[model samples]
Target: MVRLGNLVNAEGRAARAAIVDYGYRTGLLSGLAPEPRERQGAWLTPRRLAILKLIAQGQPDRKIATAVGCAPKAVTTAVHHILRNLRAEDRAHAVALDHQQGLLTQPLVPLPEHRPRRVFSALEAQLVEALAAGQTKLQIRTSQGLSAKTVSRLLTGAAAAAGVRPRRGYAALVDSAYRGRLLTARAVDRASAPCLPERQHQVLIGIAHGWSDEQIAHRLGLSTATVKTAARLLYGTLDVATRAQAVARGWDLRLLGAPRPATRATARPGAPSRAAA
Candidate 1:
């Protein structure tokens, strides 16, 4: 029986190789191969691409508007268009997608000479380093001779400059540490294991389905504010700063069901169809 199984596997391999050889010869395989949609970077105009570059640099809408010689409202509109074109959920997701597509390889436009760079104070720098090292705020306060309010203020300021939520500073720091190979596997495990409640689980599933707070609230028979608060809490628990990241993490953890696969459109009865290879 084992010999028969091996022979069957060998036959399958031979058949696959034959199909591959035929595909290469006929030039049909390339046409049928799936490519990432992000490869179509030409869809964005120069101005829109410039805005995306600024966003990648963590520039606010106002800053981007000034850099692009447009009003804040115009920047907002451009961002919406960029998001829609990229099929991204938000600015952060758009920036991430741009990175994935290698769209930010070149500097889009030079920053204005008069623009001031964001600077962190010595204490704030220490706080950020401590947070990145996985130290608690209380521990940082004790070691740095600072009060809770001072630590909070400094951390908040740093998070704002970095374009991340204040509470997400620690997670961002952890992510940096992991990327830099400074964190041990055990430490990563500890940080990644966040305790989530049943309600939060449902909320995450709703988000995975692309439901807004108002929609989730209506479906769950809860107030919009309640759903919003739950989402915030969910973000904190998952150590993610954005809704897109939360949904991705949920999918990674198998907390949410797999997305439905896209189906090909049916051809009309009289239309010509390509022969199946």
Candidate 2:
């Protein structure tokens, strides 16, 4: 009898696991297994919450450290913890999630007035603004009298100044700077302009939501190579280099509207369903 009871318990456990796996893959389960028992903000301590607020304002690690009265390394560690806890892909995602979860209601302590550093040349600024505005490289080159090589170099510099890795490209730099409230009104205006057609915009949204290229291609009913080509072209037009950065830029620019509803599918145990894309 004891052995039979144990076998029954094992079967029950397996059944529960299967159900959860199904829910997760189908988008019925919104977060990871073992979801937080408490509210989302319950896990964050007061200091971590303060750091999150600073992060939302686009403060870099050093600045966050200064404002939080902690070492820069400590701030970095906390940020990583925050990301893991939030299950966010990156800083931009963390900020967005925080806002969605209503964790940004805490009053922010203003940092002291500091002189803003001039980081970009006038020409470089114009180029970045144009890039954010969805202008093609050729259009910018023709209007600004810049060679392709020069434009690339300037973009690299701009990316560095905005505290973004240069390889992430100019769109990421612009998005980061804009999030930090560093760009001018004209730059924001240009960046806010719509640049993608409907299908491409859907593709960008899928990418932003952490969908793999193959998964996106499958859901969109396009060939994998076509999806790859479209993604590449989308990246170039947005002036971003990495998929993660492209998502960040898309979110910052409001190019990705509300997330799509999750769909039911016969996806693999852990694979996301088409609607989740």
Candidate 3:
């Protein structure tokens, strides 16, 4: 679970950004490695980090150009320059690396006029305003006649200011998030991929409450299959098969909210036992 401190703490936020950047840079950092004091190719620079911050903010090349008073193509050119310096594949990857390096946590120090600034589109700009106003995607989509997917894209584009990829589709995002959690938990274990003990119990409780896979997946940024897989894994860990058994054992183990025996609902008829099985 990403606690508020994860974002609120300056050190934690920088570390997170750097980790993400590092993950994207995997298998792509050859020339970009840190050089010895005598050796030289290219290194991560403030200019690169600035570009990354803009990309994360969802600024388009044109807007970035305008903000920096450069040609629209200049934005792309600047990005390529930054990538070469960082030995990254693309803007996204560079931004991810920046996040991982904690380069973004520091206050924004404006560059000289020669440096570029980021720009946003009217629509994209509006989206951020709406989000800041606490608007929901459904509401924004309805009012703007934009598809939910578009709204999501816009949000991602906006949130990318810090370089995190806005989850693409709702389904994909759910799966990614689910997988992310499992991976995170596994990272903690190192020897095996394990679900967090606490999360497994919470998931079981949510399932017992008749929450749909989509709902759970959306809330957890996980896919339906991941949810089911995690459930199965939890069951295996608990020596149970059925949801009831899992829930029963989970509750007994105090892994879940107090069990509600009255809510002995069964899986919906015709629903497959395993996702994508």
Candidate 4:
């Protein structure tokens, strides 16, 4: 119901992913997914599969480094390599790939009941909110004064508070935090300004969501002129002239979530490049 002029439905994507995960759990989705390349068996060495387990278990790079007897950066690099080997898009996708390949035998653990909302320090607040908003690791680090290692540390702390363990994995811990309210997602309007009126905040969020002015008007129950007028005020508040500039500034100020990635039907024909992830 809370649509900031149809802010990209990240929750919708998660739900679809959940359905796909269910299909995999029931041995019903493998045929639908891409068949594994022949080189896969050679690629997933024992070391790589072990690392994947640590990832699923919610261990961050630093902890993974400690356990794996490698540097934290090495853990990151190895994870990237593992993703390439599995032809996975992200950690969660990598988990699914491993399961389909018969490498990861254990099923995902069910989440426990909701816990009360937990208070966080300012940094923790920004990081968690950015993550929930689907901001990339790079976006968070560059905009919010956090490093990848620090992010990991914060995740571990939150996971511990939520009683998330290896059986539940890293993604499980994030889900648990959401259920327990240890993490909170920002309404695009939560990125509002002090000087702007409430309606203008909605307008700004709508703009950030890539809504046409008419669409914003329809969603907010206002005339198109009213929406345009509000957008003018929004531009003034942000000290920007165009819609694109306002959005760019919003991202810099941590007033907006991460931009969505471009969707593709297939991977490009080349080695997977390193990602911030």
| Whole-model Cα lDDT of every candidate shown, in order | 0.53, 0.55, 0.44, 0.53
How many pairs collide in each candidate, listed in order?
0, 1, 20, 1
Query: How do the candidates rank by TM-score, highest first?
Result: 2, 1, 4, 3
The C-alpha TM-scores of every prediction are: 0.28, 0.33, 0.25, 0.28
Q: Runs in model 2 with CA error above 4 Å?
A: 1-118, 184-277
lDDT by residue (161-245, candidate 4, tens digit) is: 4354412113333443344444433344543544443455566566544467887777665689977877887778777755544
Residues 146-212, model 1: lDDT tens digits: 8889888877765443334454324433222222222212212534566565446656656544456
Cand. 2 TM to true fold: 0.33
2 versus 3: better TM-score goes to: 2
Task: Give the number of the best model, judged by lDDT.
Answer: 2
TM-score of 1: 0.28
Clashing pairs in 1: none
lDDT value, candidate 2, whole model: 0.55
